[model samples]
Target: MSLFEELLKWDKDQCRVVGKKFELGSWNKLSEKDRLGMIGELIDLLCQRLKIKDKPKVILTTLDNAFGAFSPSENTIYIDRKTLSKGGILTACYCST
Candidate 1:
């Protein structure tokens, strides 16, 4: 299989493993610290699933017309804080992927 196909399959498998632990909409009720931790975990999971070697740092910030943004200079991801309700952290995870 092609690399993209492998990664897509990997992501689906990982999501199955993760889904067992988290119910739909469960990402919303976590505390800020827990949410950040979860985001970090998602990043790690994405790295493994997508085979990314250089993982970018994640930061939450206000944004306009964007769910997430990336800074190549600093190798960081800026997640829109406003979008983080109702399983919104999944948006951040998608951005990481």
Candidate 2:
């Protein structure tokens, strides 16, 4: 079976995390523009938490077979315009972590 299938079959509760989990209300109902705004907010929060000096610039682009990439030199994040972020805490930032 594929990895996707295995993930689907696994019980989500099997994994436990200590920190508080953030829950977004009406996630599916949010517009693309709203979602992008949320992503920006998440990034800002993360930067603050990590003590990052300059907030990384987020640029949406047309990518092939990939969701996003981070450039250290440029200090920027590039997300695939075609695939916007999903809900559930840092799912938008970390992608199912």
Candidate 3:
């Protein structure tokens, strides 16, 4: 099965194996630089399950929530989606290695 399928299945059956909501909060509370770095690391872990690229298919609730993705290939950062005006929660789907 694909990594995405496996990860989704695990989340459905076991719920939390590697990273969960509570654990994510601790990780998210880090500094802006740290958060971005951690997110990058998390993306690596997630890649084991999916082929993640620099451009991600972002799914956002509002255009105000902060969002960014590191483009390793181009060696640059890109904003897949932005929530510049509205206010709401942001849910980013990340691939884990």
Q: What's the alpha carbon RMSD for model 2? A: 9.4
Q: Is candidate 1 or candidate 2 better by lDDT?
A: 1
lDDT scores for all predictions?
A: 0.68, 0.60, 0.42
lDDT of 1 at 85: 45
Q: What's each prediction's clash count? A: 0, 0, 13
Which residue window of length 10 is worst by lDDT in model 2? Answer: 14-23
State the lDDT at 39 in candidate 3. 41
lDDT of 1 by residue, 2-84 (tens): 88667556555567555543444676667766766777777788787677999989888888999878899998988787765
TM-scores for every candidate against the unseen true structure: 0.70, 0.61, 0.39
Best candidate, lDDT: 1
**Sequence-dependent TM-score of model 1:** 0.70
For every candidate in turn, the CA RMSD to the true structure comes to 4.2, 9.4, 7.5
Q: List candidate 2 segments past 4 Å from native.
A: 1-25, 85-90, 93-97
Best of the candidates, TM-score: 1
Residue 87 lDDT, candidate 2, scale 0-100 = 51
